[model samples]
Target: MEIDELTPAEARIWRAFARGDYVDFRTGPDDDPADGAAWGPERTVRARVLRTLLLDGPRASGEIPSLDLSGARITGGLHLQYATVELAVRLKNCWFEEVPRLYAARLWEINLSESVLPGLIAHAVRVDGVLRMTRARFTGLVRLAGAEVTGSLYLEGARIDAPDAEGPVLQLNQAALGADLWAPGLRARGPVRLTGASVTGTVHLKDAVLDAPGRTALDAQSLVVGSSVTAGCLDARGTLDFRGARVPGTLELTHARLSCPGGIALRATSCVIGELWLFGDGRIEGALRLRRARIDSLSLDPDLVPDEVYLNDLTYGALVPQHPAERRLQMLERDGDGYVPYSYEQLTAAYRRNGDDDAARRVQLAKLRRHRRTLPWYGRVWGRLQDAAVGYGFRPLRAGAWLLSLLAAGSVVYALAPPPALKPGEAPDFSPVFYTLDLLLPIISFGQETAFAPEGPYQWLSYALVLMGWLLASTVIAGVTRSVSRP
Candidate 1:
């Protein structure tokens, strides 16, 4: 308790502090020998205030006034009591097997970054100024509930081990974080319960894992996580019950596995999610019970719900239930077992309510096509026939015109071909066989007056041969042209 009674190291550190040497204190982990005996399996640090403040490195022991441990380690716990130190304490890289209780301590900055605190077995730890822990690790439970953290509290990459190796890790039952509770990569081997805890700013749990009895990674109910609750992936096996919580901006559970007693209950009467994705067996019952919830999108895989889910009074940019029927079975159960079908009638009614007939008709047509299987077989066949006829009716006209043009062209070709004998001025026969060629031509060319104008079957055969040869030549020409153009 006296100046000369202190150890040489403690004397030197106290002397430096008295000389206003704020930046210079004991350095290195071996600066204090008190740590080995202070916080081993047995916890006892009977050393007075001046001894601790003077020569204690984080791992070493002995404390000084306003311990400047910006980057140091304490192999033992720190017991700083009634020390009138301005910028009071800084535990930058400190670890503890157990803690030495403090009393009437007025501390300013406490930096516990990159430090492993096995447990804070202290009676009470209090702080006044900023506590910046950028990447601290806690192996045991830390109780800083009633302590007033005036400035920013940063625990960005903190790892708090489960409290009861069987219970929750860090239980902030009634803690009040004034500024942002920035614990982005904070992992807990047990469930992290912040029920009834309040943070003025944001509570960032972006990539933290909360492992507990029921598989819930993090459990916060009646707890206020400021404007947003942004979790990257939550594996909540037991009920991740958020029954009466309120999130302002968004509760993004994009790729979270949710499980509950009956099923997971987002059933927080009026909680909203900007975008919610139900991945791993994410089933919900008791109404996705968002009495007046709002969301950007609610997406879920059809196979995720093994049984049934419900969405009651929920609103979103789009409520895309992978299996809406499952939700209907729970919430909109009218007429015993029923659901709101996405039918033409419903769609038309929606558009009609909006006072848009064009939109109503469009939606009706879409619904008709989508649920076409719901129609009777005869109705389906009739619809198909009508559709096909409307689409390809003009094709038959083109075919008919081509056939008629071909017949007319064949007649002209027959007339144009050199007749066996000229009639001089008579009309040329357009029949399949020219009668002049079979009768008149033969008599005129042979200089014989045939009695009956060659009216025999042989005469008919001669005319048929000429017509067949002409048709064959025309077909061969057309075939040759088609083959040459084909790719």
Candidate 2:
């Protein structure tokens, strides 16, 4: 297409592209036309004309060819599938007639900020520079699966109102970005898929709102990020899945509100995260799942309690702001999976590592109490007895107290009524204290018990004392042995 053969608007844009000048034709921000019907010739450009200039544009010696346009209404399909363009294309504040197709295309930088488009498709495309679409609005699907970007992909302040279709509204599955995938202040009305995507830098989703009721809002399964995924203040209405993700850096969702009523609000099952920080006063309306997740550290707000959390086999190496077991042990009891011993053990080990032996012992006591509920009726009765007598081996001081109480009670009853001396004059002299002591210590028989045989009610009291002695001794030994066997 020669200069004279081109339309006047196209000729002007051609001269600007040759000089690498940015062409803005709209009068003001309010001059945005939904269609080119009301637009002047200066504000209209065919998609083919833009494509032709991008591919065969005149480049000055030692100067890079560029095409930067603003406020232009594109009038046809901008299909760049499998086409290689070396210039940086910036089409800001433009209204596209339809979504562009850049499937498997090798391109340089692409910036479509503040544009209104049906959607975008750049599947399997390779972009040498950054792909930016900040503040752009997409009414349909935005596919970027298998894309390889050398620089970051920015979608800040973008509003995508793509309702549920055949797949996710914003698809970046299996894409590889060399730098960050920054999407702060992003608003999406459907599912945003990032499954199997790899980002070398952080994935920022601060102040984003994602709404996909009764379905997954953000599905980043198997996502491998080199740095953190910070989604502070994110409002996720549906399930946000990060299962199988390997984020060596922290996955910080501080102050993020999650709501998926009657379903899991956030699922990070089997994820290997360096830290999972949820330390703010965030609201969670549904279940939180971390089953089999292994986090190096966790920063949890003591007041931020989830109603239903499945922590079966979930292990964290350390806890931020670690407190005593009284304040922290309630979290282990809140597991909805019902009696996962691993959760208690993991917490116990964490407390021990902090050199808080008192906290560790308290956790052990809680574990036994939780386990007792799963036993049979008879076993539960025995468990209750041991709990009251010695706190399931965690409270050794209670055992001593119970023994002293029983000994004092037995001595008082015997001292009030003297026992009859056996064999008349041949028996030893009666001593109430020694006689009571002899009955209680079943293993050693003192001569006072053998000689002074009690009569009537005193004899029955002696038998009761002997039985109680054996029971207390057995329970004490069992509890002590349990404490010694572990740790």
lDDT values, one for every candidate: 0.48, 0.88
lDDT score, candidate 2:
0.88
Q: Per-residue lDDT for 1-487 in model 2, tens only?
A: 7778778778878888877888987787576534544676667788999988988887677666689998888889998999999889999888888889999999999999988899998999999999999999888999999999999999999989978576899999999999999999999999999999999999999999999989999999999999999999999999999999999999999999999999989999999999999878788878889999999998877667577888999989998778778777777778898999998889889988889888888888888988999999998988888888888788889978876777788778877887877777898777777777788777887688888877888788889989878877777788889999997
In angstroms, give how far residue 140 of model 1 lies from its true place.
1.6
Candidates' RMSD to native: 17.8, 1.7
Candidate 2 TM-score, C-alpha based: 0.96
Candidate 2, after superposition: displacement of residue 129 in Å?
A: 0.9
* Clash pairs for candidate 2: none
Q: Per-residue lDDT of 1-487 in model 1, one digit per residue for the tens? A: 5666654544544565543344322256554422322433221222344335533422223533355433222334455655434554554544444553344455667666665566543223445666666776666775554445556567777777654675566656556667767777776676666666666766676666555544444556666656666665554444454545656555655565555545443444455555555554334322233444555665555544434334344455544543323332333332111232432344345445556555544443343344444679986764444323221121234333433444454444444452342343443433422333332232223221121122355345445534544443343344344334422
Least accurate stretch of 10 residues (summed lDDT) in model 1?
444-453
Count of backbone clashes, every candidate in sequence: 16, 0
**Which is the leading candidate under TM-score?**
2
